[model samples]
Structures are given as C-alpha cells and as structure tokens.
Target: MAEALIKKHSRTKLDMTQGPIMKLVILFALPIIASNVLQQFYTIMDTLIIGNFCGATSIAAIGTSSQPVEVFMCVFMGIGGGVSILVSMHTGSKDDESLRKTVKTSVSFTYITAIPLAVLGIILTPVILRFMNVPDDTWDLAVLYIRIVFVGLLGNMGYNMNAGVLRGLGDSSSTLLFLIISSVTNIVLDLLFVAGFGMDVAGAAIATIIAMYLSWFSSVIYIIRKYPHIEFSFLPKGIDRESLKNILKLGLPLGFNNSLYTVGHILLQTLINLQGSAFMAGASVAGKIMGVSSVAISSFSQAMSTFAGQNFGARDYGRLKKGGRIVPLYSALITMSLGIVMYIFAPQLVGFFTKDGMAIKYALLCVHIQIPFQWCFCVLNTILNLANGIGAVRYSTVVNLLMLWAVRIPSAYLIATFWDGHYVTGGVSISFVFGMLAALLFYRSSHWARICRA
Candidate 1:
C-alpha cells in the first residue's frame, strides 16, 4: 500500500523540461493560483471576522503587526527559494544524490535559522512596532498579536521550506492540497476563536499559528511517506557544508532582497502611521484588498519561478527565455483586469472590513489611487522570479535594492513629507510603478540574457 502511494505521488510531478510553453505554464500555475486564492480568502475572512466582531482597531492591529512579521519571514522564504533552485537543478540533471543532500541541508538550515529568528522576533516585536510608530490605541493588541505570531515562526518556516522543496520537484499540487487544508482549518478556527470566543486579535493570531503547524506537519508527513527515494530527514548527519555554502551563495542575496523590500514597506508604514489611526485602518484594509486582488499575478509569478528553474536546470535556455517573456505579459493583463474590478468595487470591499465611515472613506481613496498601477507589480514579480530561476539570484537583489531604496522609499518619503500627508498612500502606490519601471529597464538591458548565455 505504501509502495503504491509512493509510486502514485512520484508520478504526479510535472516534468517542466518537456512541454508546450503556455500549456505547461497554465497547467502548473492553475492549482497554485487556486491555492493562493483560497489562502487569500481565509486571510480576508480573518479580517472580516475581526472587523465584524472585534472592530476596526483589532483589524488595524493585525495589519500593523503583519509588516514586521513579513519582513522577518522573508528570510526563510528567500532561503527556501535558494533550496528550490538548487533542488530543481539537481532534479533536472537527474542527480538524485545531490537532490537528496540539498533537501536535507535545506531543512536543517530552516530549523537552525527559524529557532533563533523566532526568539529574536519575540524579543524585538515591541521595538519594531515602536519603530513603525504604531499608534497608542493599537499598540497593545498589535504587540500581543505579533508576539504570538512570532512564536510560530518555526511552523511557518517549516511549511515554506517544505513547499519550496515540492515546487522544486515540480509538484505544486501537493503544496496546493496542504494549503487548502490549512486555509479551511484557519477559517474555522478564526470563526470559533475570534467570533465565538471573542478572544479578538489574540485569537486570530493563535488560529494562524495553529493552522501553520497543521500545514507544516502535513507537508512533512507527505514528504516522508510519499517520497521514500529522497530520504527525508533532519538528522544532523544530513548537513553538508558545501551544500550550505551553495545555498547561502544563491539564497542570501534573494533573502536580503526580500528583507530590503519589506524594509521599504516598513518605512512607508511608519509614514502611514504618522497619518493617524483612521488612515492606518484604511491603509491596512486597502493592503489586504490589494493582496487579494493580486493573487493571480502572484501565483503566476511563483509558477514561473519553478517553471524557469526546471528549464534552467535542464539548460533549456530557449524555453526559459520564452517563458520569461510570455508569463510577465500574461500576468500584467490579468492583474490590470483585476485592478479595474477592484477599483470599481473598492468601497464595497473596504466596507466589508469596517463600519467606520472615516476608515471606509480613506480605504476607498487608497484603493482608487493604487489599483490602477497594480499591474506594475505583476511585471516586477515575474521578472524577478525569472532572474532567480536562472541562478542569477544576485541580479534580483540588485534590482530590488534599486527599486526599493533608490526609487520607492525615497519617493515615498519626499511625497509624504513635502506633499500632503494625506497623499502618502498614493505616493507609496506610485512608487511601486516607478520601481517596476526601473526593474523593467534592468530586465531589458539584457544583463540576465548575458548571464544565461555564459
């Protein structure tokens, strides 16, 4: 029975190295897209539950806490990206031993980093919140939520690492299955804890942590039982110094790029914080709406990363290049269409989060100002992932730094400071467009092409 299950699971991995480009991209991307949409649905449900039961302040607290958590979580995510690239390459080359070694090292690395990072996150949550200038009214709840969420970093990191491994193996369906399970669990728990028990922000955080662990454990079990040939284990004996070195070399830049991007957003958040609680609430809700709206683009970008990674591993540069072009264009069109719908219904969507008229008004303004330019992110995510997929992860770092530091942050600060403070959200949204333009220019410079050719 176990052998049969293993064989069935193994057969499910899509071989990206051989397929019609569009068909392969869509087939690989659809399940991932569905998973992302479901994940977004549960997240929005959490916000809706909080908004309805716990009020806008609780909603704002979760929103405020989410930024710092994302900043910290990006480290693990970047490392996972590194793991996926290396694993995909090895898999493509039919180097089973190397693939197994990479998986072990990646899992070991995730544990080593996650433990300390969780501790540091717990210790630093308050300080980071202060730095973001979290308003007095929202402070205590934000702190509680962040601390609990930080404690679950191990689970979050574990799930992400496992998902990266599956993605590297060209098996997004398994990750999707796990995500659906997690999302459903989270939604039920959110309703029970926050709506039923009235634990408010703390309940939402707890529910999230429990869901994360559930997903992580599911992924771990699936990997162990269904991929016997991979020898999945976290034993210290699995650590390979050279593999670690390679992971860091490819991953550190990607990780830093993500952290740096988050840093830019934190800076923007600080500016938003200065605008007061109503704006904070509005911006918070707007951010979530935008996230939900952009799910398709985000999913496609991730799919492109894995698709390109496998092709790169197989040295199919032609297919990689073709995907690099096609996927971004497709992503942009879909994002633009979604942006239009979101813009038209911005008020209704924002209203779902709060009854506060002021909060709804400001949130509506944020959506109106930002949604039109949302397509730019599709370009940015697609190109960056393509670069990461081809082992030119460092180029992604450079591109992100240039965008966030050189373009986004400075523009946001100047606009918020010199212009009207009310324009801060718009400023940040416009900055994204500018940053994506810069990234597009970098992509067009053919620098990545040169690297791939060499």
Candidate 2:
C-alpha cells in the first residue's frame, strides 16, 4: 500500500492522448526546444573556442572528425527512437510490465552496442580522416578529437537512450533539467580546459566527454528517484529477447536507414573536404547557425511523435488525424520564422566564429543557400515523425533513403560536375522541397494505417 501510494504520488503524468492537441504539443515541445537550445550552446561554444584559440583549421577538424562517430552513433540513436515510441505506446495502453521490460532491454542494448562502436570508432578514426582527404594542417587535430570522443562514447550513448525513455513516458521536463546540468558543465569545462589550461582541441574534446558522463549519471539518479518501481542496472544485466524483438521491429529499419544516411554524409563531407579547409570551416560555422532553427524543427517532430504515439496506442485515430493537420502547420510557421531571423542575422552570427575572409564567404554562402528552404525540411520531418510514432517506420525509412541517395547526392554531384562546384549546397535546398512533397504523399495514402493494422 505504501509503495502503491508512492507510485501514484510520484509519477507526473502529461497524458498526451487526452489534452487539447495544440496546447499539449506546444507545451511538450517547449521543454525539448529549450533543451536543444542549451545543447546547441555548448556545441557553438566548442566551435567558438576552437575558432578563437586554435584557429580555422581546428574548426574544420571538429567538423570532419564528428562524421565518423555520427556514422556509428546514428544507428544506436535510431534504435533509441524505437525505445521512445514503444514506451509512449505502452504508457498509452497502461502496460506497466512491458514498459519495465523495454527499459531494461534498452539499457542492455546500449552497453552491448556502445562498446563495440567505441572500439571501432577508435580504430577507424585515422582511416576515415584519410578517406575524407583531411588537409595536412587539420589531419592531426581531427584524429585527436575523434579518438578522445570515441573513448567516452558510452556516456553520450547512454544519455541519449535515457532521454528517449523519458520522452516516451511523456516527461520532457526532466530532460530539460538534465541538459541544463550538462550544458553548464560543458561550457565551464570548455573554458577552463581550453582557455585556462591551453589544451586546445584536445581540451574541448575532454570537456565534452566529462559533461556527457555527468549528464548520463544524473539521468540515472533522477529516473531511480522519481520512479522507484521501474528498476534499472548501471551495468546492464543482459538483453531480453522478447523486449529486444519488439524494439528491433520498430527500430531496425530506422537504424539501417540512419546508418546509410550518415554514410552519405561522410561521402558528402569528402566533397566538403575537396573544397579545402577554409570552405570546410566556413560550412561548419554556417552549420552552427542553422542548428538554432533545427532545434525547434527537431523538438516539434519529437513532441509530435510522442503525442501521436499515445493517441495511436489508445486507438484515438481521430485525435491523431486531427494533429496530422494542425501540428505540421504550427511547426512549419515557427521554423520558417526562425529561419528568417537567422537569415537576417547571418553576418553577425558568422562574425562570432571567425574573421577569416574566405571562411566567412563560404560560410555565408552555405547559409544563404540552406536557410531559406529550412521550412520545407521541417514539414517533411514532422510528417515522417508522425508516421514513425504509429509504427509506419519502413515508409519513413524509404523516404529518407531516396531523398539522400537518389535526389540530394545526385543533385549535388551534377551541380558540381556541370554548373558550379561551389554551389552544391543548393542540392540540399532542392532535396528539402522534394522530401516535403513525398511526405505529404505518404500521409495522404494513409500508409501508416495498413502498418498499424498489420
């Protein structure tokens, strides 16, 4: 009776299925947006520090180094998406036992996957950098940063899995607190290690690892304290086959797609590399600026997934369909508004990173090409996320794969080969429009419904 009382009193429920749809989405998304903003701050700080202390080559190093880890991490993170969707569905259906099992399985999966990937990342860092044809000036910095990050891969991967579970439980608020702690920890450490200790790119990487571990540790404590009934292991006990099956069924296609997609990015990074370090540094700075708008775009998609997950699980097709109409409109408008502001302030923002004239030129050019079409990508993202929530992941996977491989990459190559090698970023904008159209078609066909019934 005491335990039951504790469970009832402690659980903070934001029932996504029952509330006013728009209000609930905005409320959930706000915390996620805040969290993303805080997350972006630390990322920007890393670049700002590198650009200031170590110079443009280091800035390019950071950019090129990240892709190798992202290639592996994206697969695991995609699986975490499966965890969130399942947890949300279970919450909607009020299946306590299965929810507990899914959490345990995710914990186990994280360890099993993270260790192997970390080892592989450490091994491949040098090889991958060479493949990207990293400039001689930036090569050593890129290798150092990539290896340091892989060494602490478990912490970052664990935190992402924890965040997925929290979002699934309709508890975005706790994640904001976690990000708050990590962001502050990261920025302070970045300053102390880089500025005070003169550790350079190595210092930036070290600061990031420590922050990631702390973030993951804090989340574990919070989950244990707040939900005493749901137990977890710091050292994963083992994977549960039944639970793993469910998660993989929803998650594997996503993992495969993300892995392939990031591989495409690695190839794209090769393209960025061929342009030389100055252009690469410029694109990196532009990415940081564009990352601001992506916060809202991603937050909305995540929030809608959680929202749609609950409604779909509860079999509230009406509410889910209703959101399919209203939420995308809100997402597109808000994301586009942010794009306009970022576009207006592009010069000032670019100035914050570096004063190198050529760097500034390439950065601003990429920004100009991408920012105006940002809304199109947001629309596609929101719709795909909605499909994901309802177990229609395979279709979303197909859409993403085609958008990257057939449309985006080909367009970039054709532009470079024929017209202007410098304007490949235009391909990104073209793909955004194409993806938006494809996503709309996916929704209109009600493809997700067949998947749901199956």
Top model number, TM-score = 2
lDDT of 1 by residue, 1-454 (tens): 6456546776778788897887777777888888888888887898899989988788788888878898788877888889988888887787788887888898788788898989999999989999999999999999999999988898999999998898888888888889888999999999999999989998999999999999999999988877877778643345888888888888888889889988888998899889888888888888888887787776788778888788877888778777877888988888898888888888778878889998898888788878888898788888888878878787778877877787777777887889877677776566668767766764556666574575
Worst 10 residues of 1 by lDDT: 442-451
Per-residue lDDT for 257-286 in model 2, tens only? 788788878877888888898999998999
lDDT of each: 0.83, 0.88
lDDT of 2 at 105: 95
lDDT of 1 at 46: 89
Clashing pairs in 1: none
Full-model lDDT, candidate 1: 0.83
TM-score, candidate number 2: 0.97
Candidate 1 shows a clash count of: 0
The estimated TM-scores of all candidates read: 0.95, 0.97
CA displacement after TM-score superposition, residue 319 of candidate 2 (Å): 0.6
C-alpha root-mean-square deviation, each candidate: 2.2, 1.8
